[model samples]
Target: MISHHLLLCATPAKALCCPDPAAGQASWDSLKRLVREWGLEDPARPEGIVLRTKADCLRICAEGPVLLIWPEGIVYGGVSAERVERILREHVIGGTPIDAWIVKRLPFRPAAA
Candidate 1:
């Protein structure tokens, strides 16, 4: 049996914030295709890919639709349908997190609103 190895971050709140869920779905759909094409889901492999969409607050509301890669602890923000394909194909499959879209951790402060 192969162990799962991939996580997708998607919260309902975050998804609601997206300009279009269709776009988000499209993005996720493409990544799924790549995972199959890359042989990340082979049952005979020692490890396999897993995509998870979580429903917790990442605390980056300004940057909705965030994705976090576990073990490596990398977080990406402001992701769209178009960019997700490249991220999965080049970064996730390639064993490198996409830094260009990373969401840097920062001190949290309550909004004045």
Candidate 2:
């Protein structure tokens, strides 16, 4: 079972979000590496595996290198390589979100079937 989905806007086609595309790429790389290293992809885990996607643009263009965590719908801004670990350890693994870095939160609202 997949517990969470992390969507990171790293390389936007227009470069409107991040002035430097390299920084965005770095954040994406960090996210990819950490997710694998932390074993968040293990389907057998109790919390379930975490899936990650590199989004070209998340539509919140002001905050470059933004990250969006699904289900919870927590959008974190200014996501750099240095911040990836804490976000994973505190929010992804520990089940607690870091409010400080959170830019916006749009809770999941699935339509009735």
Candidate 3:
């Protein structure tokens, strides 16, 4: 089963996404490519699979291409295709969060008992 989830914005509201809409699309494509390249999306992959999803809008679209790493709720902005690999390598696989590119963040909240 998949343990990690990344939701990237696919749509923009009021042209809020940084630079242009293509940036978000680029992130979506780069994210998928990197995940596949790292074997995170393979069906036969080991435990802790990461699933990448595309969303219409994140509302925090001004500084975006926003990417939300779920369960941990790490939100990153300005995630262009150029930054995907570093984000994946440093943050996703290495268990370290990248602070410089972050737009906003929330502590990973667990389900209530």
Candidate 4:
């Protein structure tokens, strides 16, 4: 099972689910780079490795640029490139999420293999 599940909304312009598509794209890009740099993108990566993907919409329209991390279910809003970096360092790798940036937090559940 993956250690972390990252869902980022990279919706098209004018979409209600995301207000700032540019920021989402940046966050997506940052996440990709950070994951690989952290050695979490290997095909044979360990069970507690991160898996990230770009999503069409995350259903949190008001804040735009939404990012969700699971199985902790720490949902963050208004994500940008800068925020992505800290999240990768502090949350994904360090095991402590940035509470201020978090918009929602759901019960933690281990990912099914």
Error of 3 at 1 (Å): 2.6
lDDT of 4 by residue, 18-108 (tens): 7666777788888888898878876677556788988776666657688888878788988888898899889988889999999877775
Candidate 2 regions exceeding 4 Å error are 110-113
RMSD of 1: 7.7
Better of 1 and 2 by lDDT: 2
TM-scores of the models, in the order given: 0.63, 0.93, 0.85, 0.82
lDDT of 3 by residue, 3-99 (tens): 6799888555556665577887787888998999888877787667898888767777667878888768888988888888898898888888899
- TM-score quality measure for candidate 4: 0.82
Ranking by TM-score: 2, 3, 4, 1
> Each model's C-alpha lDDT?
0.58, 0.90, 0.81, 0.80
Candidate 3: RMSD to truth: 1.9
- Positional deviation of 66 in candidate 3, in angstroms? 0.7
Report the Cα lDDT for residue 93, model 4. 81
Per-residue alpha-carbon lDDT of candidate 2 for residues 47-105, written as tens digits (9 for 90 to 100): 99999999888888878789999889999998899898899999988889999999998
Writing each residue's lDDT as its tens digit, candidate 1 over 29-112 gives 665776677676766545554544543455545465666665456667777667777776666666666778878533346569
